[model samples]
Target: MTTLKKTGARLGTLPLAVMVLLAAGCGTQQAGDTVKAYRRSYPTPSTPADFLCPGEDPEPTAATAAATAPSATVPPTDHYAENHGFRVPIPLHGQNRCDGLTVTERVKSALEPLRKRGDFAPQHVQNVLTDLGYPAGKVYQDGPTGVGFLIVIDASPWCVEGTMSRDSTKADAFGGYPDGTGCEPPQGGH
Candidate 1:
């Protein structure tokens, strides 16, 4: 009776071990299938054959050189000055005119009153210029540099000029002054 009981216990443990082994084999097969499916869904990316390494200079082709060449049809104009990196003001008048007063005088009259106030807003200066018949744009506030409020005016020919800095007491104008030299300001205050 003791021998039979020991054999029965061993037989029960053998079936459990076989079931665990079969489950492990099934799990391995599922994992392998999942890996195969993922690989099929997303293929590996390929590098371009003509890719250049860092600091490698490529030889310019004839087509690229021709495309970069300057065109002869374009006439040389003072467009560079007009479209400078800094924002420029728009002209009050459609074209350059020497009518009432010069741009300098107009700007001075507009800004002096505001400057006397001792630290007025930039909008106030812009309004003064607009009210004085000179439309102002690109108003910049001086940050840490103590440069003050800088205003730009599209005053051509008569002044081809604008203000560089406008503080609490004064405003500084730049571009051709006194005689309006170094300016071709008839077409859009260039």
Candidate 2:
């Protein structure tokens, strides 16, 4: 075969290669790395978590601090992505706002039924989220990276981000990000 044809054939298997790598990397979640403990580790400035909230820094007690100013130092037991491949500038958020944990469940469940249809087009996903009570205008989407895409709903108090992957066969939804707008991953604090 010509060099060009050989290169094309190799490229065709790129997706498969990526899938294999990803599968292997996602071994198993650690016991302590449960979603309940997946705290937001973002907004870490020289002054520790002083830049925690974007606006109106609340005087946090031990009770409310868990929801408001979560630890930016302690990481979840499973730092799989960091060790495996992906390196995020900001940390992942937890389900604490706008009833985020519930919303995340709702979004994940809503997508599950539609997964078999293979109709996870951006607009469709947004519409579905809107139907579930979120604003249509606040939703954001990016990419069909291999067989996946990202969806983040600006659920006001928190950003509910969902990553649809492996040709819509699976999805992982979570809450929060340390963005200035309390939504989207634009980098930096609050």
TM-score of each: 0.30, 0.40
Our tally of clashes for model 2 stands at 1
Which residue pairs in candidate 1 have backbone atoms (N, alpha carbon, C) closer than 3 angstroms, thus clashing? Answer: none
- List the candidate 2 regions with Cα displacement exceeding 4 Å: 1-71, 75-98, 137-156, 167-179, 187-190
Clashing residue pairs in candidate 2, if any? 179-190
Candidate 2's TM-score: 0.40
Q: Candidate 1 lDDT, tens digit per residue, 116-137?
A: 5554566666677667666454
Using TM-score as the measure, the top candidate is 2
Residue 102: error of model 2 in Å? 0.9
